[model samples]
Target: MTIGGHLEELYGLPAFTFPGPGETPRELPEPDAVAWRITADSYDAEEQWTEAFARFCSAVDTTRVRALAVGAWEDAYDRGPGDIIEALVTARDRLPGLRSLFLGDMHSEECEISWINQTDVTPLLSAYPALEEFGVRGGQGLRFPALRHDALRTLIVETGGLPVEVVRGIGASELPALENLDLWLGTSWYGADSEAADLEPVLSGARLPRLRYLALRNSEIQDEIAAAVASAPVVARLEVLDLSMGTLGDDGAAALLGGQPLTHLRKLDLHHNYLSEPLLRRLRETLGSAGVELDLDRDDADWDEDDDGTVHRYVAVGE
Candidate 1:
């Protein structure tokens, strides 16, 4: 059976309850567990899916649900962006216990520009005050909502069209307790001259005071910008840094690695850039001397590998 099928089976089980003011609901059976997958090929299907989702949200004890995954088909063209955003916002508000939210195949017609302009993401963010990790995939032009969650720690944006400014706007203060940040920009960002301009504002602000892990993937950044990002005051306390697919050449990579004030950093990722053998050697030597673990992904392999893949392999730089 498919993953969706298995999730559906999980949702069909009895409701899971907890100790609260009212009766604790039991967990759903297997068949109904995958309520997040709404394949709206036809009007009837769309209506039925929405209705089922609403009912599930209202009946299921959200405190028992831990993760939420929203998937959209690449060819499903019937639904609009507003429909998906509305549905997602509804579910987010209803599921207060949600700790992780994954937005998959986000390029569907349901995630168009108009949908973003119309959707009020602030309320949805406000609802999930306990959210810990958020992942957005396959969409562009998504604005950041002013998040006030003390529990938020990880924010991952994986899209080709997401702007740099949006990523930088997520300051440490915005997530006072934030620790990990993962950003994957699209190929379109490579042509921009001021790619790192957006990040300056957040770096100057009191954002991410306690940030430890940071990842910047698939962005077209120059040496100067990379240096600036590395030298940013807020990042001085970082323990992990990932710059996969950032197009940082030897000079840029060297600048960033050499200029970084991250004394406690333990892990560093530099993948899919124009690093020659000499530059790679230099990076290894420099970071090794600093006692940091380097995770390097040369251009020899495909970058879209799974967790078990070799996209990120640890290399000891120093003795």
Candidate 2:
């Protein structure tokens, strides 16, 4: 399944809540539970944060907790939510059972998904070496230092504008157990400097052997990416190939349809693209006949020409 599928599973499961400041029951419902969330914004003021967290630590048997969520830590105005990371690091020993962590689960009211600035999260991996699933939202100031992990299975980075260096860094990393990898390569206007060539390591299938689900969604240059992916050796092993939420026009869709054998893939997501109805009907017949679950939700808006009559296309999310 895709990371999106896994996250949906996580969201559906019931969670054990860590009581906030003004909540009725100020306690941990199940200290030994598998899923839990720490919403620091519940505290009345920033001054009460430390003490509230201390109480949370005291209530829960941290050593037995498996999945922990860090959400709405220090508001959007704060310094990139680094303080929450520090707190987790300080209490690292207490959370030895932590395997899955979801960072930046704040709503739009707390912080717009794209506006949530994040710094280098390399330290988190070093601190929790056994962590298997790591999900982070936002891309501003985000950096993943040289990493070598043995237990990490799923790595997800959601962003409005991901840098090329970050993609290169992921490709350069040594992740022996990685199975699912999702990267939202947003518009160039934000910070998407990387081209399709930058993803050569992943496309060549030289870096990750266990990878099965790969998502290169939300991109401006979806056509180039689609062409590269269709010819890449990695597609031979991938069960789900997601090229959703992009500006994939007829040319890109045609490249994908003509380049590879779609019978092997279990599912293909091309929702929110610029394919015409004729192309969509063709895709539905071809891919559906191959028994692939296809997602072709949004039709693109009509293209507009600049003063020089140059046509321009756009991706789903960037700003």
Q: Could you estimate the TM-score for every candidate?
A: 0.68, 0.89
TM-score of 1: 0.68
What are the RMSD figures for all models against the true structure? 9.5, 3.6
lDDT top scorer:
2
Tens-digit per-residue lDDT, 100-126, candidate 2? 887766655566556678888877888
Task: Tell me how candidate 2 scores on lDDT.
Answer: 0.78
| Local distance difference test values of all predictions, in order | 0.53, 0.78
Which pairs of residues collide in candidate 2?
Answer: none
